[model samples]
Target: MKIDWAAIGSVIGVSLSVTVGLVALFTLGIAGLSRRERAAAEGNGGGAIAATGAYVCFAACAAAVAYGIYLIMAKS
Candidate 1:
């Protein structure tokens, strides 16, 4: 039996990076939504932009999650 340390390390690094990145993106989406709500209460024009940004962030997070699922399923 042989252990490929480099392959193991790369997989761990990539998985951690993807996990953190998705979490950060989702957090930003939530923050943008909160800002939109605040702007709406303040009667401002910035809510539209914030809403658009929030949607983009949320979509990206969803896509990343779907892709991860596909990768796992593909191996089976």
Candidate 2:
């Protein structure tokens, strides 16, 4: 069997691009949530719930990206 390096590279590049894009989105979401949380905290309001929810969402996004990368790598 022969390896098609070009195809492999294409798949890897696409997968990485998707992963990075999703991560960027998640980062932006987290950043926005953090800012909101800070504002709420300074206003004498509880922000822990919102902060925790943002962390959970970020983790979920990371997991999804990892799963997508795994699928790409597993493809023949």
Candidate 3:
């Protein structure tokens, strides 16, 4: 099978961008957790659910990025 370098590059570029974005989102989630923890300590019930949702989103994005990378690596 002939390899399409342009397609491969595009996939890799997109995957890398996704991975970076997810990592940034994961960082934000962590920050949210820290804020939430402080709020909880200060007697506020906020951020727990949002933090969880953020983590879930980060995981899904990471998985998508990994899948994209896999597609780029796999021969067609």
Candidate 4:
């Protein structure tokens, strides 16, 4: 039996990074929305920018997920 340590390591690295990256992106989106609400209460007028940032982050996350699903379904 032969073990491909390099391939296994690469897969692990990619999976770990993707998982962590997505989580961080999602967290930032949530934080952005909260910040926008707080800023609105203070009449800071910065909520628009924050809301935009949040939307972009969320869209990117959604795209990544959809692409992943597409790739998986493509394999069949």
Candidate 5:
């Protein structure tokens, strides 16, 4: 019974990168919300754009999570 070290390493690398990317995406979403609030407080007109971007980020994150779940439950 031989082990596939390369396959294991590949999986680990992909998993780590995806996890970091997802976290960063979520963080950006949070930052967008903060910016939108600040803009609103200052009576700026950019709040709507920022809010829209923030919602898009959140939707992307949700879609990614849903795709991952689908992959896990998918049959080959």
Candidate 6:
């Protein structure tokens, strides 16, 4: 059987990029949370914005995971 090297490379590249993107998104969520806490301790109005950003990041990550699961289960 002939190997489809281009298809194999495409899959590998996509997988690695997605993995890195997810990790970076999650890390940003964590960093936003940390900044929120710091702002809260400093008695500033910045915490609210940071908290909102952190929640948005978390939601995006959750949605991405759910979509991935759905794709696997759909098997279409």
Which predicted model would earn the best lDDT?
4
Per-residue lDDT of model 6, residues 1-76, tens digit only = 9999999999999999999999999999999999999998998888888889989999999999999999999996
Distance from true location, Cα of 47 in model 2, Å:
12
- Looking at model 1, which ten-residue stretch has the lowest summed lDDT? 43-52
Each model's total of backbone clashes: 0, 0, 0, 0, 0, 0
- TM-score per candidate, chains pooled: 0.93, 0.54, 0.54, 0.94, 0.92, 0.95
Residue pairs in steric clash, candidate 4? none
lDDT of 3 by residue, 24-62 (tens): 877777776787788788988886776786677668767
For candidate 1, the per-residue lDDT at 48 reads 86
lDDT over C-alpha atoms for residue 50 of model 6? 83
Give the alpha-carbon lDDT of every model: 0.93, 0.78, 0.78, 0.95, 0.93, 0.94
What would the per-residue lDDT of candidate 1 be over residues 1-76, giving only the tens digit for each residue?
Answer: 9999999999999989988998999999999999999999998878988889999999999999899899899999
With a 3 Å backbone cut-off (N, CA, C), the pairs that clash in candidate 5 are none
The alpha-carbon lDDT assigned to residue 7 of candidate 5 equals 100
Q: Candidate 2's residue-wise lDDT over 4-76, tens digit each?
A: 9999999899888977877786886687588667878699456666677677778778788689779789995
Model 4: lDDT of residue 18: 96
Candidate 1, backbone clash total: 0
Clashing pairs in 2: none
Please give the RMSD of candidate 3 to the true structure: 4.5
lDDT of 3: 0.78
Considering summed lDDT, which 10 consecutive residues are worst modelled in model 5?
Answer: 67-76
Shift of residue 20 alpha carbon in model 4, Å: 0.8
